[model samples]
Target: MQDAILDVKNLSIRYNGASEDAVRGVSFTLGRERLGIVGESGSGKSTVGRALLRLLPGARVTADRLRFEDVDLLDLSEREMLKVRGRRMSMILQDPKFSLNPIQRVGAQVAETYLRHFPANKAEARAKTLEMLAAVRIRDPERVHDLYPHEISGGMGQRVMIAMMLLADPDLVIADEPTSALDVTVRLQVLNILDGLVRDRGIGLIMISHDLNLVRNFCDRVLIMYAGRVVETLDARDMDAAEHPYTRGLLAAQPRIGGTRGPLAVLDRRPEWKEGSTP
Candidate 1:
């Protein structure tokens, strides 16, 4: 972990007046590799991502240690955290419609991040914005650049979001259900772009999703989360060898291409499973 870009330990988050923490005792280190967090909805996977970026408004977040590079995120004020958000670290949200400005042109939105973080003039930012759009494999970047978010398709919008978030070449990128909006073909394309970013630039990536198969195929490491805690963490290729019952159950529940054409096995809920127990 000496070269880890992000180190989080005992991180927890709770919304106002919540009976229990939304995220509990999550700890993991992200190096320059793709780390996927997999769990069902409301499993605190997204909460962990938001907590890292300090984006959980009106929520109490605490951690024994939360460091990005050499900077301690927990100690930084909101104003100081702004300096780190887009330049040093960035997040790709699940949906582009909610993440992007409906009124602004896609090119302007992408250029805005580069302009905000770097001392680039309008022309320079625009050039870099078009370059990034092309980097994400968007055809005719010129036309897409001037189109509004509503004018683009879901896949294109997601690509625009990706272009904007990565314009600054952040050291860490947290993607929450990044490819969920695209078709299988577009999903692979987007995944390839993310893979290239990590492989070529050495940027750490945290990919949050419920797709076990996708994570196993695309990521270097996988963290299995249940309820509010991480039940297990293992190499992506070793996911089938996961010892935790929750992870094993999840793997079994997935319908295989040539497997029996029967109803998927139901996940048996166990009270003790939520106690942060890991086999």
Candidate 2:
């Protein structure tokens, strides 16, 4: 943790007039490694990621400590946050169709990040954009750069999103369900590209996902969330050894190859599970 890029402690978020918190007392430190957050829908996994980036609108975010590198994110004004957002940290959204501009060419959108952060000439930004497109394993970077978001396949769009987010070489990247929209083969390809970037650049990655199997295979550590709290944290390889009943139920619910066919087990909800416990 001495080389931690992001340190979050006692983080919680709630929308105005909401009866309960969406995320409560979640705490973790991220180093230059892949960390996965997994849970069912409405389990507050994405909310935690949004809170780290201050992307949740009209929501009250509070934390005893939420520091990215040397900067305190909670204290920075909205104007100042703009500088930190794409330069030091970036987010890859769930769907590129919604995140990317429909009208703008792909290369232009990628170059926009470079132009915003650095005082580079137009020619220089274009060169960097092409270089990044190639880095993400896009076939024929020159041809793909000229295509619009709609013209490319889902897999290519996600890779473009990765290329855009990593244009400035951020220290921490929060990817929220980045591969959820792709097919199996494409999903693995996208994961490979993301993994390569994180490893080669030594950047911290927070992958918010609902796929337990993918996280177990792709991430270094996993955080099991329930309701609004982190119920358990363990090495991704040791997910099968999870002690919490909620975690156990999730593993049971997953369909296994060559296993007996039966109805998936339902997660038995418990009130005590939301009592803000940490592991």
Candidate 3:
């Protein structure tokens, strides 16, 4: 079995001035493989992802245990956490437009990201950046290198974001709806790039998305979340065997291609589950 790359235990987070916890006693383990997290918006899915990286600002984070590679994340000082963030663990946000600097050339930004974590010379970093851009299937890496973020299409920008993150050579990547804003074709292309990255690099991935079909096809294991907690987890191959009502409801909501159906099934809305109750 692959070794555990992340271990979260009784983790909780509450934003400042919020009456309710965004995440509550959430716990799970990640191995060196793909683990998909599926939940609708406002389900604290993104909160969990940010919390893992200690990226939640103006929020209180608490956990009995949060470990990565036997290192206790909760115990690390901010200075120490800085060393871990981009080097050992990285995240790709939904939109690269907001993530990438508008003024900087894409290539320079990517190279800078690499240099932040590694002691490589300028020539080495630039070469590595070009290679990463090519790895993400960007056409004409040499030309694209000098282009600013605004000069690129949405898909190209996203690819640049991926190239930057990958340059850190992170062991684990948290991709939070990484393709949510892209067109259908671009979405697939990005997914393919991500697929190759995981396969070739042997890095673990936590793909957080509400797209059931994508998760079903791409992930090795899946976690179904509602309200701030995991309601079910199953092997991707056994997703059809999901036992929770919420999981079934979600699956039923997806329209099958080439099949005529009535209005999409509506999910039953319950009051968000309290922390002490069953998910």
Candidate 3 lands at a TM-score of 0.95
Q: Which regions of candidate 2 deviate over 4 angstroms?
A: 276-279
lDDT of 2 by residue, 197-221 (tens): 9899998999999999889988999
Per-prediction tally of clashes: 0, 0, 0
Q: What is the C-alpha RMSD of each candidate to the true structure, in Å?
A: 1.2, 1.3, 1.7
Candidate 1 positional error at 96, Å: 1.5
In Å, residue 162's CA in model 1 sits off its true spot by 1.0
- Collision count of model 2: 0
What local lDDT does model 3 show for residue 103?
A: 92
Tens digits of per-residue lDDT, candidate 1, 1-279, equal 879998899998999899999889989998889999999999999999988899888999999999999899998999999999998899998888888999999899999999999998999999999999999889899999999999998888888888888889899999999988678887887788778866788888899999998899989999989888998999999987889888999998999999999999878978988894764
Which candidate achieves the best lDDT against the true structure? 2
Q: Higher-TM-score candidate among 2 and 3? A: 2
> Clash pairs of candidate 1?
none
